[model samples]
Target: MRVTIFNYGAGNLFSIQAALRKEGAKPSVTKTGSGMKEADALILPGVGSFDQAANSLPMEEIREVIRSGKPTLGICLGLQLFFGGSEEGRAKGLSLLKGRVRRLPPSVKVPQIGWNTLNVERENELVSGLDKEPWVYYVNSYYPETDGKWVVATSDYGVRFPCLVAEKNFYGTQFHPEKSGATGRTILQNFLKAAKK
Candidate 1:
């Protein structure tokens, strides 16, 4: 499938693209509306601040892609971008998912960088064939709080926080599955499978 990766000046796109290639999926990087419209599925990978990331490209096509009900996945700041707003900046988000991104509780380290075990919640397509409590790489200060039961996974830094979320055709992960080794690639594979479904 033509899986498009959003390249809005805020993500580790190369690694994600490479991972998609490994999964035998045709992936392309784009930052324009038309480029987004041509894709069967999309991946929004984020590694920068929420405000800068969202404000970089306020493309309506990207928003519509999420609303179109086709499979869409967000990683790290990409996950935070699904919220109505973020604590990192004043810029509003696409609001595809019901929630707000806020600073990870101060009880933990500031960046919350490094590997952490993921607590899988429900049996969703994103983690359908993966093991529970898989260790994934994370690097963020803000976390998403969805109003509904969208939470798919949780992780502990200083306190437990939502590590992954899935709602209908929408999916998000706070951890960088592309950087999390074998299990990480497996997570991407799970996403690819979901997209195919």
Candidate 2:
């Protein structure tokens, strides 16, 4: 499968590309959203702050493509971009879903780096074979505060927040699947399978 990873200039591309390759995917990187509509799947990788990444490319055009039902996966900051805006920046998000990205409560550290457990709250193809409470790698401070209708799974820090969400063909992971080991690989493989259909 041909998968395009849209670079937000500060994107973490290598690890994700390697992960995609392991899943039998032909992964390529693009700084802009050019030709992304042609790919079997698209990824907005987890890296960088909100404003810088949002401004690095034409998100408006990219948003249209994603809404067109092109299979999409967003990780960390990439997932935050699915919301309308974020407390992290003045720039707007794609607004594909109704919500905002907010920082973790003061009770927790600024950046929640390390492995956290995924509390599967709902069923979806993304978490198909994951443990009920699988541990996944995370390197993030902000989390998406959205409706339950869009949330497929959640994780707890100072508060329980959406960790996995699916809306039509768009999916987002608050944790970095590329670094989450075998469990992460399963999630990506599921996405590829769904995209192939």
Candidate 3:
């Protein structure tokens, strides 16, 4: 499959590409809109503040891809950008999904960087072969706060927050699937499978 990884100046392109390669899919990294037109699937892998990432994105181009209903996956900050807006910055998000990203409660460590278990709230192809409660890697200070309808899985870091979400063809994960191990590869493979359909 031709997977296009969006590079809007804030994503971990190299690692993400490596992960995709490991999953048996070659990836093309680009910041231009032209790449999206020929892609079978889109992966937005990010690692940085929301405002900077939002500023770097080609808004109209991204919206066009979303409107087309192409399978799109967002990781880490990439996922946060799918929301209406984020508390991390004043810049608006792609707003592909109805929700807002908020800073994690002060009760827990600001940036919960480590392995955490996910509580699957619903079943979907994205987590197709994952265990009931699978461990994934995370590094973030903000999480999405949305209705249960959009949440497919959640994790507890001081509070039960949405960790995995899906709405139609769009899917997102708060953790870095590229950084996670076998479970992460499964998730990527599932996303590719979904794209084929």
Candidate 4:
């Protein structure tokens, strides 16, 4: 499949691209909106502050992609950007999904950077072959706070928060599937399968 990786200036594009390639996908890394028109699927990958990434994104094109119902996946900060806004910065997000990204409570480690188990709350194409609960890697200080309507999975640090979310053709993961080993690969493969449908 032709997967377009959106590089909004602060993402781990190389690793994400490499992972997609390993999954047997043709990934094109682009900072501009040029080739998005031909994408079978789009991935928004990020590893920095929410506002920085939000400000750099080509929203109109992204919205068009979403409107077309092409499968789109967001990773890490990319997941945070799916919300209305974030506490990490003043810039607003794509607002494709309802909610805001908030800083993790002070009770837990600032950035929970390890393997955490995923509590699958609902069945979706994103976690097709996983167990009821599976372990995935996460590296973030903020989590999306919503009413659990779009949350398909949750992970607990000190507080249970959204981990994997899906709304129509859009899907997001708070963890880095590219770095999460076998389970992660399965998630990506599932996403590709969903895209083909």
Best candidate, lDDT: 2
Better of 1 and 4 by lDDT: 4
Give one digit per residue, the lDDT tens place, for model 3 in 31-94.
7656787888888886678887788878778877887898899998889988879999999899
- Cα-based lDDT at residue 43, candidate 2: 93
Residues 82-106 of candidate 1: C-alpha lDDT, one tens digit per residue: 8889878898898887778878787
User: What lDDT score goes with residue 106 in model 4?
Assistant: 97
- Measured with C-alpha atoms, the lDDT of residue 45 in candidate 4 is 89
Best by TM-score: 2
The alpha-carbon lDDT assigned to residue 118 of candidate 1 equals 88
TM-score of each: 0.93, 0.97, 0.95, 0.95
Ranking by lDDT: 2, 4, 3, 1
How high is the lDDT of residue 135 in model 1?
A: 87
How far residue 145's Cα lies from its native spot in candidate 2, in Å, is 0.6
lDDT of 4 by residue, 1-197 (tens): 89998877744678888988888899998878668878899998866678778788788778877878978999989888888889999997888988899999999988988999999888787888986668899999999998766899999998999999999898999999998988899999998888899
Reference-based TM-score, model 1: 0.93
Q: Which stretches of candidate 1 lie over 4 Å from their true place?
A: none
RMSD of 1: 1.6
Residue 52 local lDDT, model 4:
76
Off by over 4 Å in 4: none
Sliding window of 10 residues with minimal summed lDDT for model 2: 4-13
1 against 3, candidate with superior TM-score: 3
Error of 3 at 38 (Å): 0.7
Residue 164 accuracy (lDDT) in model 4: 92
Alpha carbon lDDT of residue 72, candidate 3? 91
Give each model's whole-structure lDDT: 0.81, 0.89, 0.86, 0.87
